[model samples]
Target: MEEVYGFEMSDGTGDFFGYTADHLFADIWTRPGLTDRDRRLLLIGMLAGQGAADVLGIQVPAAYANGELDDEALREIVIFVCHYAGWPQGARLNSIVEETIAKAARRAARAGESS
Candidate 1:
């Protein structure tokens, strides 16, 4: 959360951070019902449906980073989402996915160079 938002949750949010950490991240996210990949897929769908590009920008890349999604799978998801979420929403998500993939590749190349 700090890396994504640029500040710790305890940096003045009071109990808000505690609730997020204890409930949202620890309790809900750690539940045994769904795999991390399943959670990522569901979140992507929900965010795309609501036109939440800002959060999607973070999440889509995270999906890639966590191995929950690959390029082809992400493309397929965008195409599938187009039918229910409208073309514009799908297009925007497609753009985000492409950008995320490219950024991940750049990061990987840089990491390899430093090795």
Candidate 2:
């Protein structure tokens, strides 16, 4: 969860969190057939197609932070997904992707300056 979301989670919250940690993250995410990057892309496509901007917001930044996606690829995803997912959802995705890219650039700059 922390690896994908970029934040540490508390331990033993409840059944919901437990199932998420033990089953979703531990089992499903770790399956060997697909790489994390591949899963990320598939997840993004599904989220975009479903018009799930809120969740996509989290995944987009995490994907960028984890080096699974770059600015160009993210933008290209917007175009491709928009064609199939509808223009309105694509607009939402485009906004999220651009925002994520800008935030990532700012973060990198701050890290560079701290060095």
Candidate 3:
């Protein structure tokens, strides 16, 4: 979970979280065939197509934080996906991507200042 999402998961025991931890992240995400970057691109496209802005909000930031994507790649994804996903969804995705990059830059600036 930490590697994939750039965050830790709690040991939550319910069916949903358990399945997420034990199956989705542990089994599927860690599988050998696809790199995390490949998965992230596929997932971003799917989510953008479905107009899943909220989840994209989470995923875009995680991709940036995990170094699976960079500013240019993330920006290009918005343009490419928008062509297929439509302008409205592209608008939403663009907002999320830009905000995520800005937030990451701000965080880096803060860390540097602290150092």
After superposition, which runs of candidate 1 have C-alpha atoms over 4 Å from their true positions? Answer: 1-12
lDDT of 3 by residue, 1-115 (tens): 7788888766676899878888989999889999999999999999999999999998999999999999999999999988999999999999999999888889999999999
Q: lDDT tens digits, residues 1-115, model 2? A: 8887776676659889999898999999998999888999999999999999999999999999888899999999999998999999999999999999888789889999999
| Model 3 Cα shift for residue 40 (angstroms) | 0.7
Among residues 3 or more apart in sequence or in different chains, the pairs in candidate 2 whose N, CA or C atoms overlap within 3 Å are: none
Report how far off residue 86 is in candidate 3 (Å): 0.4
Q: In what order do the candidates fall by lDDT, top score first?
A: 3, 2, 1
| Candidate closer to the true structure by lDDT (higher is better), 1 or 3 | 3
Point out the worst 10-residue segment of candidate 3 by lDDT. Answer: 4-13
Backbone clashes, each candidate = 0, 0, 0
Ranking by TM-score: 3, 2, 1
Clashing residue pairs found in predicted model 1: none
lDDT (C-alpha) at residue 32 in model 2? 94
Assess candidate 1 and give its TM-score to the true structure: 0.83
Candidate 3 or 1, higher TM-score: 3
Estimate the lDDT of model 1.
0.83
Q: Per-prediction TM-score, please?
A: 0.83, 0.91, 0.93
lDDT of 1 by residue, 1-115 (tens): 4333333456646687778776877777778999878888899999999999999888888777777789999999999989989999999999999998889799999999999
Mark the regions of model 2 whose C-alpha exceeds 4 Å error after superposition: 113-115
